[model samples]
Target chain A: MTGIPQEQNDLAYDVFAKACPSRGTLEHVTGRWGGLTLGALHQGSLRFNELRRRVDGVSEKMLSQTLHALERDGLVHREAQPTNPPRVDYELTPLGRRVTERLLALIQCVEGSMDDVLASRAAYDAGQRS
Target chain B: MTGIPQEQNDLAYDVFAKACPSRGTLEHVTGRWGGLTLGALHQGSLRFNELRRRVDGVSEKMLSQTLHALERDGLVHREAQPTNPPRVDYELTPLGRRVTERLLALIQCVEGSMDDVLASRAAYDAGQRS
Candidate 1:
């Protein structure tokens, strides 16, 4: 897959490559707000307020930015409601669902090792101070 | 797990919370160079230059910073040899191996959907132009 069909494959970006768009996409997928937003949306479609609460600690500006990024990435779909005040709902697209599953799996694994990680940090910090 | 054992759990940070240390650790696990470094180290131990080559396009400053962060987190261990040239090898710690496995899983999933993501971006940009 390295050098095959240079013209065609050249268009396909590799995250490992510094110049690739995939690197940016990867960053968005794993960023702090991005990760939390996906985690919330993974549960179900969420309105603006619901999403804001679900992610916890995310400000309106940050949530808006994260959803915009996700929507632009085609992982999320935003639908506006026909109401006097206007309402918007956010949901994960098929592509978003796939990415969320993988990310959540990683999050779970990290949580799984929380005990070990915390312990290691304690030990490391103690050693560093000595 | 939210409010149980306030004192004990307080010490155990939650990533969802804004002030949690886990959030920073999670970011490191998923950052550009951090992700690539973990992917490379997941395979096995490697010397400094070998690691630099493996995670292509990483500057010496960035790699050093990333490795320092990972080491401080106890996710990576650095072994320096007693040679005149001072050879150094980096490997994933047990906790690191677990985190790396999960992070790599996410990275692979992202790579798996590269086609969809790229196509989505193209369609998005095309639509924005219209």
Candidate 2:
């Protein structure tokens, strides 16, 4: 098609016409630590330490920052209980659950096709060297 | 379900088991300027200056950096035609096209659901204050 179909064009414009909400969501959801945190929370509610454990390479500072962003955005619900050690738990809010489901699907799609992408990279690198 | 279905778990593990190629692709696709560049190129091949115009808010330095990453990863084919004005056209390789199609889909999905996300954010902020 020479241009996006009118309906699709309208949809795209509707997205771009606003003050750019996607930029913020994209920042929160796709941040370096954000994806891994969401992936870990997808399984169940987690304490701060539990999240740290589940997402392998994230440092304490990054994980805390990511959790705060997600929390502020309303995707994650954090509850603190008065206890000896100050127990806290994090779980997806309804909105969080919906977004996480979509995120997981995207992650799966990427992971599934990664082999082809790697092969493409190898070929591209080889061509560049020769 | 208590856990991801065994098959899905295998798939997830398969993805996490590797040296994490998704990390690189994720970096390229979701880089600050990368998504916009891909979206602009999706319409058709264009010269360097043309791309700058189509994707609003990108700077020359960021655009050049993004193009190089995509080029290295084989998602973009940069054809430099030896001519007086130095005509260079950037287009998607077969791999690029495949990936771009998926990226566009993701962008559309995010755009479609942005309103809900905004509403959620407002509610979240209100809750925090009270």
Q: TM-score: which candidate is best?
A: 1
Number of the top lDDT candidate: 1
Residue B125, candidate 2: C-alpha displacement in angstroms: 3.4
Q: Report the error of model 1 at residue A24, Å.
A: 1.4
- Estimate the TM-score of every prediction: 0.86, 0.78
Supply the global lDDT for candidate 2: 0.72
Scored by TM against the true chain B, the candidates give 0.88, 0.83
Score residue B111 of candidate 2 by CA lDDT. Answer: 61
Give DockQ: model 2.
0.29
Error of 1 at A59 (Å): 2.6
Candidate 1: tens digits of C-alpha lDDT, residues A31-123:
889998998899899999998887779999999998888888888999999997999999999989988998887876665556566667788
- Runs in model 1 deviating more than 4 A are A1-13, B1-13
Task: Give, for candidate 2 chain A, the lowest lDDT window spanning 10 residues.
Answer: A9-18
